[model samples]
Target: MTRQGQGFVRHIELDSRVGTDRYPFSLPVVTHLAGMGRLDLDPGVTFLVGDNGSGKSTLVEALATAAGFNAEGGSRSFRFASRSSESDLGDHLTLCWNRRPRTGFFLRAESFYNVATEIERLDEGSGELLRAYGGRSLHERSHGQSFLDLVYHRFGPNGLYMLDEPEAALSVQGCLAMMVRFRELLRQGCQFVVATHSPILLAMPGARILQIETGGTIEQVEYEQAEPVALTRAFVNHPERFLDRMFADDA
Candidate 1:
């Protein structure tokens, strides 16, 4: 399915007026955005790849918050917060929307338990809200199982999704399954912006991979050039070589 012009988000622009002395602003990727006028989003899927502390999750969370989803993680309507640890960057981020999504969700692996608790709270009275999520509390299922259920049962066509490190809970096979489901959603006119490290998820066909360099540069890289894919491929093809180098350093 060609998702050429059906995406809700056209791009994201950072306000230059935002201060550079803050937490997220001090981050590399955020600094990059401050200088770079705007970041264009792919219509189908856009994958943000970077090492830990590179600000990928911070960016994704800000996008979700700027787009009206809860900062912790959940749909736009979910207004509960377990604790406020989100950065102030969301307030300075602006989304340019070509179209509006019919449905949407923000899934952050670290705060998913809080989102699940919010879900249970919303489902207290009638259980009707839980029905959308496969008629069970997300907390009842394993982490990976709950994620799969959200993808299969709650997510629908023409939706906008923002995910941060979804592979944190998913096994290798589960990542593969997520890729399959992601394709189905793409075909149904869904758009996704994911911050992830899984080579498996990053390998989704037609997805654009944006790599954030240590110096705060965001470059669009091909599948072979993506750090996770390249490293995984090299390690899998010759584990002994990498192991030898590591052990040699200690020797």
Candidate 2:
């Protein structure tokens, strides 16, 4: 289970001189990175957890782009762009690689439809490309099913995967399934960088959880300390209490 020296990317660094007046650079998390110099990555799985706009997704997207995956979400070979909403932060980000991945994927939940469309286009004339993705167009499957298909069929050993809010389309059961797949892939020498809000996904054993604070600080935290886990536990344990607090004014 020792993952030392097994990851493709060792760390990521930001250029100190990168401009700070832009959309992403102005973001608190990005500003933190500008001063932090470098962020070291775990060799197995690294989970970025935070509230909305904390810059977890933005960081994951920038990492994927800097690592050569398409900004719209797909493999390195995928070159189609539906639109250009991605920030230019990737250009200023630098990855330190221990070894290059033989295969890889960037999966952004918001833009997966475009990735599927690109897959269908590539599968034109022949089904070779489609076969690699569960032998069916991702569009033909339900959202969660398609995500699972990609994890089970397209992803392989010794690959690098970056995911942003993968739980957006998945149910609780699906999240458990993804966790199982992630463990299997990790044992097969794959590495993952994920930005997620799901408490279930955050419980992956041995995964490094980096919690992004509101002030733009990223700190490694235990499963018990992760905000998603702690908050979910509180809500689940005493729903009435939380509900009462929310409606206290009315009472």
Q: Identify the leading candidate in terms of lDDT.
A: 2
lDDT of each: 0.91, 0.92
My TM-score estimates for the predictions, one after another, are 0.96, 0.97
lDDT of 1 at 137: 90
lDDT of 2 by residue, 129-235 (tens): 98999999999999999999999999998999999998889999999999888888888899999999999998888889999998999999999999999999999
- Clash count for candidate 1 is 0
lDDT tens digits, residues 1-251, model 1?
A: 44533789989999976756769888877878988989999999999999998988899999999999999999999888888889978899999998899999999999899888888888885889999998889988999999999998999998999999988998999999988888888989899999999999998988999999989899999999999999999999999999998899687
Candidate closest to the true structure, highest TM-score: 2
Q: Model 1 misses residue 142 by how many Å? A: 1.0
Candidate 1 regions off by >4 Å? 2-5, 249-251
Q: Give candidate 1's whole-model lDDT.
A: 0.91
